[model samples]
Target chain A: MTQDETMISVRNIGKRFGSVVAVEDACFDIRRGEFFSLLGASGSGKTTVLRIMAGFEAATSGAIFIDGRQMDAVPPHQRPVNMVFQNYAIFPHLNVADNIGFGLRKLKLDPVERRRRIDEMLELIKLPGFGDRLADQLSGGQRQRVALARALVLQPKVLLLDEPLGALDKQLREQMQVELRALQRSIGVTFVLVTHDQEEALTLSDRIAVMADGRVLQVDTPAGLYERPCSRQVAGFVGNMNFLPARVVSQDGGSARIDVPGLQTTCSISAERLARFGSDISLAIRPERMTLHRERPADQANSVSGVLHDRMYLGERTQFQVALDDRGTTIAVSSSTTVAERLGSIDPGAQVWLSWSEEALIPLGND
Target chain B: MTVTSELNAPAGADKTAFAGLRRLFFQNESLRGLVLLTPTLVILSITVIVPFLLMGAMSLWTQIGFDYTDDWSFRNYGIILTEPLYTTLLLRSLGMSMAATLVTVMLAYPMAYFLAFHVQKNKLIWLIIITLPFWTSYLLRVFAWRVVLGYEGVINTGLMEIGLISEPLSFLLYSKSAVIITLAHAWAAFALLPIYVSLEKIDKSVLEASADLGEGPVMRFLRVILPLSMPGVIAGTFLMFIPTVGDYVTAALVGGPDSRMIGNLIELQFGTVDNWPMGAALAITMIISITMVGLLFMVLSRLLKRWVAA
Candidate 1:
């Protein structure tokens, strides 16, 4: 997005609490109406960055611009952003309508107008006839929806969510994820979500910024992040990536031939993903990208023979751990249940050949 | 010979009896709970319930010239209702206690807030420090207040030394304000405990949520923090007001004849006037008034909760 279209411009933001650095110099542009997520594990400083943007925290160094205004001096109340806290933070003393209408008091709308807007929000959150219910009466999922409505009612320039679905169970979390996505689409408001769940970030965000050790490792589209991570850290964090020690054989204009010592095979990959290192590199591939075969295939250019170390059935897919002959290390290979059924004696102790296209191997230099 | 025969009937019978007794006591949950509570229940009845029942019965009798006659009448109550002396003292007691409650709770709330929000480590130490003065005897504390608020006491003497006053302020002691002030200081710890607990129980995120929702500090306090802490405020108010209403020691120590409350009058009736029924009646009247005020407060608090929520 262009600079003019950027809703939040975080310019080299750094935060420190006394001696410990919580977030390094992080910089990113969140586009207007974009669902952007800061994905990381615990202590990755994603929430700290979100808090800084919301003005609940002041960055020790650097500046933040929201809708083209410097937010360094602006307090949380004056900022054009609202947050749904992790615990929902619904006022136990206030009922549903009061909680949603909390921020709207600044507008000083007439009673009827305020009531209409509150009811509209209740309807949006699918809580009809729940305006009078106190917060204590609502269930966890209901509380979450109310918290969303409370923030969304203000129609702020941006909505910041700090692990909003972290407290939910597996089934409810998935349901809320879908509902949250649909709600964002309907509102067309820019959303900045901070979560430790990589799957959640990938599923809900238009752009995901993977963070590690208080640093923004990479920011990319979900598919791009999954398919072509810039570093081994980002690739490994986003999904199950198997790494094999490799060396660059040669480099052409558009592709690079890499030699994998562990697999004892040489494969050519797109030069665009070639890491900036000497010859030593690490070849990373997703388990689902590599296929298992009954015998060595003559047509396949890249193939490695290995013994099946373990077999795991995961409903629709089956995972196979293969121990390569050249290197005793095991690599996980996944296939659809149908493909696994076609392979004879799909059990441990069976000999299998693992094969994949050259594009499946992402060259991440020894991280 | 018959008794010997019964005793020797069956040794198994005694075993069966013991087994049944054990099962009856252990298997029945409610019964077991009652048995466990029996000691406490008996002690409470003897120390509290029996005295309360006797006081209620005595309040109905009349004292006829040093002899308490069980004529079963509300003559003592009728006298208290009709006498201007009794009525004024009761009203003054209620008014002073109300002022004391308000002052104590108001003063305690900020200290409690400080403890809850500002002090991070050694919270128990801070709490103990807040209540350190209360560890002293209540009467001793009242005497200490007497030393502070007396005509030639700490406040007046200190002011005089600073050349802020020409003479010791006579109004500082032997007045209704003096008693109120003493009561407030003595009961401050009670107010602080509840207020601190409720304030500490408040989720920090809720305050953040309020700020995020576009409320500055002042408005946030008025709308969110203050309302959420009302339970504690109400509890503190009750704890101070209810007991202080019948407080005679503070008045006796620092108050003049003009500041004598219903408690002082009740004390006089029981001790000097030698009228037990009259004292009992006066005590009952104070309780009834206090109960009415308590109920009124409950209703008002309910309305306040609803109003804030709505």
Candidate 2:
């Protein structure tokens, strides 16, 4: 991206707490008006990266540029960035108006302008006339909005949010995820959110940089990352998957022929998707892609012989665990409507067939 | 119908009673908290409240020599208020204590701040060091201060050694300045601990958040640190000021007639004059004055809080 379009450029940024490296060699460019997310599990340095970008943490060695200005040595307050902390960090001593206008107060804005901005922020957050209430008086969702208003009122070039909705319950969390995305879009400022929740990241981010062990694993759109994971770890982290140990029997075009112990099957999987070449390579398949059959299908390349172990009846679908002959468990999800017909009222020990499309069997990295 | 169905059941009745009790406990958390703190309440009433009540009652009575009677009057209060000498002594004590508390706070604040936010390790060591002077005998410490501030004391000797002054400064000893210094030293621990506790209770993350909001170190200190530590500042001031007003030892050991505090005058009326009534009256006057000052400080603290909130 060009310098003008790129709101933040993190170059070789690293952070170390004594001998332990919290984040290492992290680099990324965030464009203006993009809703970007740093997705990772706990202790994966996503929060550390956001803090470094926000100038709350000093880089052990590296530099950050916000709007073409070096920010490695700049303190957090002087930077043109505001953060919505996981805990909200609303000034407990101040009411809603004061909390929202805290940064504005530092600007020496006229009282009328400050009040006007605070009122505008409150309305934008859908919390009109909440100025007189204490932060503790608000509910969880209200507090989250107040936090967002507090950051947005500053009109920062970049807004860093660290687990912004992690404190809410599941229902509210899901609702706020969409609300936050719309808010970010409406405000037209680059938003950098850090969260460990995969669904939250996928739902909110226009682009996501997946992190693991203080390193960026992949940077892609949410759909791209989900549909095309670069590694077995990323695939497992992003969604559930079933793996079958296989060896590459032959290679043709961009696809590979693989063999498994239980069946001499020639499954078509992409060669470029493989992380390593050896006698052992796992063919990763998602559970939703697998189909269960009562009787063996006439002709299927990627098919397995198994016995139906048990069935978990979810509201929308049913997940069946099939015990394969190779001592591996393969799970298959069928819609509740077709589950009974496909399985034919199967018991725990009924013999079954698990089959999937050729494109469903994606080769994964050795992890 | 369901309630009627379960009404005859013994299990349901027992469960309902237990649930009600649990709900009651949950609802009156303040009462439960007081119940949990019964030991503290009992100890405070025995050591503090009982003596205070007795003192208040004693202040209203007249005593004839060593005789005790049911007779009560405001004669002692009248004597204390009418006497300009006692009133002057009381005012002098208030001034001295106020100065000492202010000086102690000024010295303790930066030290407390450093210990709270700056120091990464061995914090307990620094705390002990700040409290080291108090570990020794209070009388010994006062006497030591007297010696140090004497005509041929360490300050004069050190100045002579440095060739800054040829002779000792006689005006420095046996005066209000000496009393102020001695009282400050005596109460330094009181001032430091409350301030330190307040500083320690401050959420470090709040300060970090303030800094992250674009405030410089000085502005953050003014806007966050000082305001947040106000409770401790008030606590430390009251902790030092209230007791210092009644202090007589430092005055006797180091102060002259002009520097004599309320405690010294009260002791004089009872000991030399053998007039318990006047002494009790003086004691009542001091208590009332100190009580008013303490109440005023509390109000001031509340007002400051509102201002900070604004």
Candidate 3:
């Protein structure tokens, strides 16, 4: 991305709360009009980074730059960003219209223009007739929409959302996720969301920064983070992966033949496919990448023999726990229910075969 | 549990009737509740209701030379309506209480706000400290104020010692301001508690939301904090003002002849003046007037709260 495409440049920001480190050396650039997300578990310091960007919390070191202007001296109210708090924080005393019009107060727009703006926002949030409804009268999903409309009515350059849909039911959360993406697209404003839910981050973001233990582990697109994560932390967080101990057998200029004793296979992996780290290297494979078969597949290079310990029939997929013959190490294998049905039923203690392509093996880094 | 048992008390119903009544007592929930409340009701009827009824009856009767007159009349109320002394003292008492209520609420608001927002530790200890003054007797508190505001009291003596005045300040005591100041001080805890409770009930995130919406600290307080804390403000005003309006002890101790209130006049009629009917009438009149003023205040405050929110 060019300089103009960069909307927010966070440079080495850190926050310490008196002997407790909250965020340390966080650095990332959010592109203009892009829906970016900071994905982490609780206590990963994602919220702290978003707060710093919104000017709610000042970083103990480094600074934040929005639209190429340093925001160190700016207060939250004066900053060009607005936040939708975790609890929505709808002013209880005010009705929906007044809540949305709150930030418009400082603008001092005429009455007609102000009403026009508020009505426009209400329409955009699909709450056109909810102007007279008080905060407490709103349902959870409606309150989430109203919060979005309130922040958007200010015409901020960036919108910060902190677990905006965490309070909604599962069904409502999925609906709001779709609507949130649509809203962000229509407005074409930079959106920086903080959430611990990896699925939400993947579905809503153009790029995600995975954080752990107050540190940003990696920043990548959803597909990139899942397929080519630079570290073990990002791989495990984004999706489920089984780690297999591997050793280097030989190395060429562009490929390395590694011995994965757990899979009972030796495969040649391209250099770009490995994130080699730690004293002993380990390779990761997604459960869905491995195919399970009753009979030995002929001429398959990456094949292993294991015993079927158990199987779980999920609605969309079937999960099998296979213990490899090498050391009785259990590795989870998942396949579509259709594929598992085609192979017939397999009982516990029955022999089975698991196979995968060389491209499925991803080497993880220790850090 | 059987409804038919009520219709059949039995032929030899002596013991059977008693047994049936006991079963009814155990079965009827509301009956048990009424029986449980009888003792409190009996005590209240004797101590509060019976005296109020007697006072109401006496307020309509004319007293003749200490002998009881059963004939009911409005002669005492007519006197109150015609006498300038009654209305003057009544209005003076109201004005003083209003002044006192205003001062108390204004002073207590900051203390309550500080307790709610700034003090992060030992909150209960601070609460106990503010209420520590109430551990002293009410009369002792009034006398302490007299010492602080008397002719040669703390303020006057300290000023004289500093050579700021040629003579002691007489206005410091035996004046309406003296009564107002003492009343404000004496009832401060009543004002502080309600204000503190209301302020504490406010969600801190609402204040942050206000700041995020581009309001500075002062505007946030005015727009958010003050309006949200109005319940406590209204409660504090009522607690301080209503009781002080009928307070005789404070006025008698610090107020001089000109600063005498309606409470003092009513006490005089019942005591040295030996006019029981007149005293009863004055008490009834004060109660009615305060009730009306309090209702008006409540309506106005509700309107103000809604207006500010709007």
Interface RMSD of each: 1.3, 1.8, 1.6
Clashing pairs in 1: none
Global lDDT of each candidate: 0.91, 0.84, 0.90
The estimated TM-scores of all candidates read: 0.95, 0.89, 0.92
What lDDT does candidate 3 reach at residue B10?
63
Clashing pairs in 3: none
Task: Name the better of 1 and 2 by TM-score.
Answer: 1
Q: Sort candidate 2 into its docking category.
A: acceptable
Ranking by TM-score: 1, 3, 2
TM-score of chain B of 1: 0.90
Top candidate (lDDT): 1
Cα lDDT of candidate 1 equals 0.91
Compared with the true structure, what per-residue lDDT tens digits does model 2 show for residues B1-310?
A: 8887777698878889999988988899897897789999999999989977776677777777676454777877877778898788999999999999989999989989889888999999998898898789999999898779898898988888999999998777789999999999899989988888888888776776677777788877777777778889998999999999999999999997779999988888779876666677788789889999999988988787767544
Residues A1-367, candidate 3, lDDT per residue (tens digit)?
A: 7889999999999999998899999999999999999999999999999988877789999989999999999987788888888999888878999989887878889999999999999999898899999999999999988888889988889999999989999999999999999989988999999999999999999999999989999999999999987877888999888988888777788987888889878988776565345435778899999999898978567898899999999998999999999877899999999989998989999999999998888887655
Native contacts recovered, each model: 0.93, 0.57, 0.48
Model 3, TM vs. native: 0.92
